[model samples]
Structures are given as structure tokens and as C-alpha cells.
Target: MFKIKKQISKLYMASILGNLSLTGAWVAILAARGYSLVEIGIAETVFHIFSLTFEIPSGVFADVFGRKQMLVVSSIMRVIGSICMICSKNLTMVCAAIACFAVSYNFSSGSGDALAYDSLKLVGEEARYERYAANQLILYRLCNGISTLCAGFALFVGYKIAYASDVLVTCIQIGVLLSLREIRLDHTGTDRKQEVLQSVWKELRVCFVESLRFLKKAKRAVFLMICNSFVGAVDIVLLFFLQAKLPQTGMPDSALGSSLFIMEMGGILGAKLILWCKNLRYRWVFAVTSVLVLCGVLIEHTGIAVLMTLGGFVAACSDDALQVRTDAILQEMFPSEQRATLISMESFTFSVIMIALSPLAGIVFSVW
Candidate 1:
């Protein structure tokens, strides 16, 4: 029982360490490096392409193997991705680095939550998963906000050092992960390499087919996933472009990080406050949050730095509020056997939306 509680704590720790990336202001860094908005958009598209491809497969691997192992793979990929970014000299090289980062994201996306949820299930504390998810969002937002606060420092030091710092932090995260015990409901104790491979393939196939069957019957889950993904994609694009747009409004270099940090606080607030809406219907919640996001978009386009930053804050807040609620609902809907794969499907939806929106948004924001 103590080990189970400690597992939850470690998951929180992992979330904090994972999001404390100094290169959180990558968009601004790229703009400073003379990359055009279109070029950056292409790079983002490359990332989602890789994400779209690997998202489900990675989740399947997590279910078949172990979530802990997949998370370790995520850290390794992050280190490699950081190294690639440090050595990158051109757009193509940047895209290569982005692809590695995408793979890193794919590996860890569903595995963490699935691990935490299943761990709780073992101790019959699964009802607490919503609170845990909310706290995870809060940690993610706060750490990411702090990282955004380092934009000035990252920009000043250049990408090489900025990404090298990330490499060092990720190495530490890997150490933390090594201490986590694998939480699997089933064990295949096969020693033969060929047999193990065959077993894995069989499990992957079963997981995928079962996930599809569940989705076919669960239409509401599908709708919730799509709606949440669309809103998230829009807010993310707005935030990404704002990293460059904020500076264009004549905001001083020193204040850039602070402004971004303020914007991210909206997410933290939203995550904390969403619990208030527990009694409200999901549709009503979605309606109100979607309107808030659109209003933020309108404010962001006003060409004023203060208003634009405020707009970002509002959008982030609303987006996260909706996200927490949506995630909790979806987690309840997903079966334990296919939890990671289904969560990956949610991420897959987001990647699809991002791929469609990123380049067009870049062009629109650049011209506007």
C-alpha cells in the first residue's frame, strides 16, 4: 500500500521533471534564429506527422510490454532529440530533431496515466484518479510556466546550450524512472526471444482490435475526444504563434518570459478550478469553454501585446478546464485492458487536428 502511494508521488515528480524543459520557448527561439513562420509551421507539421504515425503503436507497446519500459524509452528519445537539436544547422535538421521529440512524446503520452490509473486500481483507489489527473495538469502547467519564464535566458544562450540543458535534466529524469516498478496485470514469462516477439505481436493485435470495437460502440467518447482535441489544437497554435507575436508588439526582451509565464498561469488556474464544474453537463461545459477560447483568439489578433497576452491567458485557462473534465470522463469510459491505447487515440486525434491546422495557422498569422 505504501509502495502504491509512492508510485503516485513518483508520477507527479516525473510530470514536473518532464515539463521543466528550458527550451519551452522553442517557437520564439526558432523565430530568433531567422526561421520564418512558414518554416516553423512545416517543422511542427513534421512533428505531428511522426506523432500521428507512432502514437497508437507506442501505446500498444506500453500495454503489451510495460508502461515503465515505455516511459524509459520516452526519456531516451528525448535525450537523442535534444542532441539532434543541438547539432541542427538547417530546417531539415530541425525537422529531424522535431521527429525525435515527436517519438518521445508518443512513447510517454498514454503510458504515464495508464500506469498511474492501474496502480490505483491495484489498491482499489481508482476513484481518486480524477483528483490525481487534475493535480497532474496543475503540475504540468506550473512547471511549463516556469520553463516559459526562462525564454529570455534560452534565447540569450542560443539553442545549443538551451537544448544541452534539457539533455542534462532528462538524464536525471531517466534515473528517477529506473526506480519505478512495472505495473502489469498480466505476465508472460517466456525466455525465448522469438516466442516473446510472437507474443508481443499477438497482444498488440488484440489490443488494437479491441480498442476499435470499443470505440465503435462508444460514440460519445468519440465526440468528446474530437471536441477536446479541436479546442486544444487551436489554443496550442495560438500560444505557439504568440511566442513570436508578443515580441512584435514591442514588448521588451526582458518582459517576454514574464508575459509568457503569465499566459501559462491561466492553464494552472483552469486545472485547479475545473472541479467546480463537476455537476454541470459536459455539453454545457464545452459550449462555455469554446466561446472563451474564441474570444481569446479575437483578443490575440488585436496587435497589442498586453491584450494579446491576456487573450492567451484566457484561452489557456478555458482550454485546460475543458481538458481536465474531458480527460476524466474519457478515463472512466476507457477499459483497463486498453486504457493506454484508447488514451493514445485521444492524442492521435489531437495530432491529426494539429497537422491540419498548423501550416494554415502559420500562413494566416504571418500574413495577418
Candidate 2:
């Protein structure tokens, strides 16, 4: 048997490197290229549309091919996307870059946790998946927080320079992925061979059928999944547009990365706080944190940059808490067999909502 903890540690490192993409300045980069708010929205909408379309298919591919392989594919896509963003000078190229990012994200989403949980199960540490998951989330926010801070500093140099840094980090992440050994757990002797023989169309149908059956019994999880989608979509719009919105509140452009970095720092602390107080009920914590997030967003709408910055911090903290809680609950609700497929379904819902709402948000900003 392979070392489960060792694999988890490797995955954690990869997650950190993968997210350190100077993300705080993505919208700013496009804006710097002269893309209007509406055009930026259109690009995101295209991303969501392509993402929703490919999300499930990619998840199915992960299940059949192997999660480690899918992650490697994701890293490659991210590298290509980063290159596109670095070289982009117009709307078409930026949109193409966003599409690559969308595809890359879908490939990584369900597979990482599925791979981690399966590894734990293989080593008889399956029961500790919740704790393992919590650690992963903590690392994710912590890395993102650090990257955002650095990204702000990099922004002083140039937006392209920041994106170039992101590309280099992503390339290193691929090396991390290369070190992960793929674990194929097949009880039945012929499962792998059978999968190879099955047509792609058949695999798609099987994944869909199995997922629907599980969703039928897991109503609460289903509801949470849908709600998470809406919340996530709104959060994405707010996150991307936040830097742009700050100028109206008398905030200077140079401080945008710092503000975003601070907000991400708050999320890291919130995640750590959840780990510190593990006795808290997930349901109650999720409810309370979500409400706080809503309040923060509403306050942000008031056009006061300082208040908006504080609101962003509050929103980031609460949102991170909510995500940790939701991930735990969903882990409890679904068995390992269908975990990745179910998670992909949830992401598909999120993309659909973003596709519908992103354009409207763009229009409102454009008109303003």
C-alpha cells in the first residue's frame, strides 16, 4: 500500500501552487487591456457556458481514466490558459484564455477530493477524510492569501508580469502532480479492462444514471448543492469586479491588490478558526456564516470603498466558513463511490447560474 499521508501532503502542496496565480488582478488585467465591464462579463459568461458543458464529461473521464491523470490534464490546461492570458492583447484572446481556465477548473474540481478520499480509504484512514478535507481547505485559503498579497506587490511592476509569475508557478505545480502515484482500487478483476472496452457514450450514460439515483435519496445535500451554486455565482461576480468598483469609493488603483490580499487573509483565518473550534455544529455555523456573507454583500453595494473593503473581508471569512461546513456535510451525505460525480453535478449547477446571471451583472455595471 502507498503512503496515504504522503499523498495527501503532496496534493496539498499542489493545491497551493496551483492557486497562487496572482488571481487578485485577473479583472484588472482585462480592464488594462481595454475590455469594458460588459465585455469582461461576456468572457466570464462564455467560460461558464463551456464549463457547464464540459464539467460532467470531465468528471466521468476522471472516474474512468484515473483522478491523478485528470489532475495532470488540468495542470496542463491551466498552463496553456495562463500563457494565453499573458499574451492576450484583445477581447477575443482574453475570452479564449478564460475558456481554457473554465475547462481547467472543471477538470480539477471533483477529482482532487475524490483522489484524496480514495487514497485515505485505501490506507484505512477513510474516517479521517473530514479532517483531511479541512486541512486541504485551510491550505487552499492560506496559499491564496499569500499569493494575493504578492500579487498586489507584483501589480506595481506590471499586470503582464504578474500573470507571467502565475504561469511559472503553474508549471511548477505540474512537477508536483508528476510525483503523485495513481492508485487504482479495483475489487473486480475486469473493471479496468471493461472500462477500456466501453464506448464513451456508454460511460456518460452510466455516470448520469448513477448520480441521479444518489441525488434522489440525498435531498438535503441536493438543496445545499443548489444553494451553494447561487451563492458561488454571486461571489464570483463580486470578487472579479471588486477592484474596479473601489475607484468609485475613492480608493486608488494601486491599493486594489492590497485590499484583495487582506480579504483573502481573512478567509484563511476563518478557515483556521473553524479547525480550532471543531465542536461547532456544521448546520448552525453554515446558516450563521451565510447570513453574514449576505449582509456583507449588501453593504458592499452601498458604494463606500472602505466599508466595501471591510464588507469583503467579512464576506470572505463567512464564505470560507460556509464552504468548509458545506464540504463536510456533503462528504457525510454521499458515499465515496459516487462522490466525484455528485460534486461535478453541483459544479454544473453553479456554472449554469453563472452563465445566466453574469451577463446581467455585466449589463448593470456597463450601464452604471
Candidate 3:
């Protein structure tokens, strides 16, 4: 039990370290580099395209081999991505870098949560996974917020320096990841012998088939994933565009970091706030958050700097609240053996939505 608690604590530390990147405001950096909205949209689409392709396969690898292994791969990909971005001098190079980032994201997305939840499950503390999930979200939001607060420094120092700093942080994160203990689900009797006899391809095939079978029967899980992902995609698009849009509202470059930081605090708040909504039904939670997100969109379209920032904040807040709740519900529904793959499917859903939304949102924001 003590070791399990320590492991969970380490996961929290890893989350903080992983998210603390000097180049967190990549959209703003690209805009400052003079990329047009259409070009930036293309870059984002490139990312989701690779993400869509790799999400499930990466998850299958985690389930078949080990979650810890996939996370290490994620860190290495991040380092490579940062280096590529540092060397990038054209949109094509930027797209290549973004594809590396997408691969990094794919490897990490479901692996961490699977590792954490299974670790807790070993100790019969699975009920606490929701709290852990919320805390992880808080750490992610706060760390990313701090990184965004460094936007001015990142901008002043330039992309090479900013990306180099990210490489350094990722290296440290890799060291942290190396120290994590891998959790394996227990298989007994005939199942144990079957596991020993199964080839890697067989294991992967089983995990994939099981995940698909589970999803087919678990319609509620699929619905929850789609709804949560849609709201998240919308909020993310608004926040990403705000990095470029805020400046055009006459806000000085000096305040850009602070504005973006303030907007991220909404996510932190939402993560915390969802814990208080334990009594609310999932339907009510989804409905309310969806409406709030749309309200944020309406608010952002006003084109006033203050209102737009508020819009980003509201959207982020609502998005995180729904995300935490949905993750908790889905984690409970998933079987341990197929956990990571199923979660990756949820991410696959998000990537699809992001691929569809990002380009259109970019053009609309660019025109407006």
C-alpha cells in the first residue's frame, strides 16, 4: 500500500514535469513567426492526422508490452519533436515537427491513466481514481498555465531557445519516467498459461478485438466519449486562436503571457469544481457544460479583448469539468486488460473532431 501511494505520487510529479514546457504557447509562437492562419491550420491538421493514425496502435502497444515503455517513447518523441521545431525554417518542417508531437501525444494519452488506475486497482482503491484523475488534470492545467506565463520570455528568447528549453525539460521528464514502477494485471490458472504462450501479435490482436467488442456493447461509454471530446475540441480551438486573436484587439505584446495564463486558470478551476458536482447526473453535467461552451463561443465572437479572454476562460472551465467526470466514468467502465486501448479510442475520437474543427476554426477566426 505504501509503495502504491508512492507510485501514484510519482505519477503526479511526472504529470507536472511533462506539462511544464517553455514552448507551451506554440500557436502564438507560430503566429509571431509570421505564419498565416491558414498555414497554422495546416500544421494543426497535420498533427491530428498523425495522432488519428497512431492513437489506437500506440494504446495497443501499451496494453500488450507495458504502459511505462510507451511513456518513455512519448518522452523521446517529445525531445525529437522539440529539436525538429528548433531547426524548422518552413511550414513543411513545422508540419514534420508537429507530427512528432502528435506521435508523442498518442503514446502518452491513455498510458498514464491506465498505469495510474491499474496501480490503484491493485490496492482496492479504484474508487479513488476519480480524485486522482481530477488532481492530474489540475496539475496539467496549472503546469501548462505556468508555461504559458513564460510566453513573453519564450517569445523574447526566440523559437530555438524556447524549443531547446523544452528538450531539456523533456530529458528530465524522461529520467522521472524511468523511475516509475510498471503495474501488470494479475492472470490466474489457465489465463496465466495463455498469457505466457501468447505472442506479441496475438496479444495486440486480443487487446484490439476486446476493446472493439467492449465499445460495441458499452454504448454509454461511446456517447460520453464523443460528447466530452466535442466540447473539449471546441474549447481547445477557442483557446488556441485566442493566442493570436487577443493581440489584434490592441492588447500589447507585454500582456499576452499574462492573458493566456489567466485563461488557463479556468481549467484548473474546472478540475477542482467537478469534484463538487458528484451529485449531478452525467446527462445534466454534459448538458450544462455544452451550453456553457457555446456561450463562451458567443462571447468570444464579440471581438473585445476582455470578453474574448473571458470566453476562453469559460470554455476551458466547462471543458475540464466535463472531461474529469467523463474520464472517471469511463475508467470505471473499462476492463483492466483493455483499459489503455479503450482510452486511446476516446482520444481517437478527439483527434477526429480536432482534425475537422481546427482548419475551419482557423479560417473563421482569420476572417473575423
Could you say which candidate leads in lDDT? 3
Name every residue pair that clashes in candidate 3. none
Quote the positional error of residue 27 for candidate 3 in Å: 0.5
Candidate scoring better on lDDT of 1 and 3: 3
lDDT against true structure, model 1: 0.89
Point out where model 2 deviates above 4 Å.
Answer: 151-153, 186-201, 276-283, 365-368
TM-score of each: 0.96, 0.90, 0.97
Q: Cα lDDT of all candidates, in order?
A: 0.89, 0.76, 0.90
What lDDT, from 0 to 1, does candidate 3 have?
Answer: 0.90
Return the lDDT, model 1, position 148: 87
- Which candidate would rank higher by TM-score, 2 or 3? 3
After superposing candidate 1 on the true structure, give the runs of residues whose Cα lies further than 4 Å from its correct spot: 186-198
Q: In order, what is each prediction's RMSD in angstroms?
A: 2.9, 2.8, 1.9
Worst 10 residues of 1 by lDDT: 186-195
Tens digits of per-residue lDDT, candidate 1, 281-316, equal: 989989988999989989988999989999999999
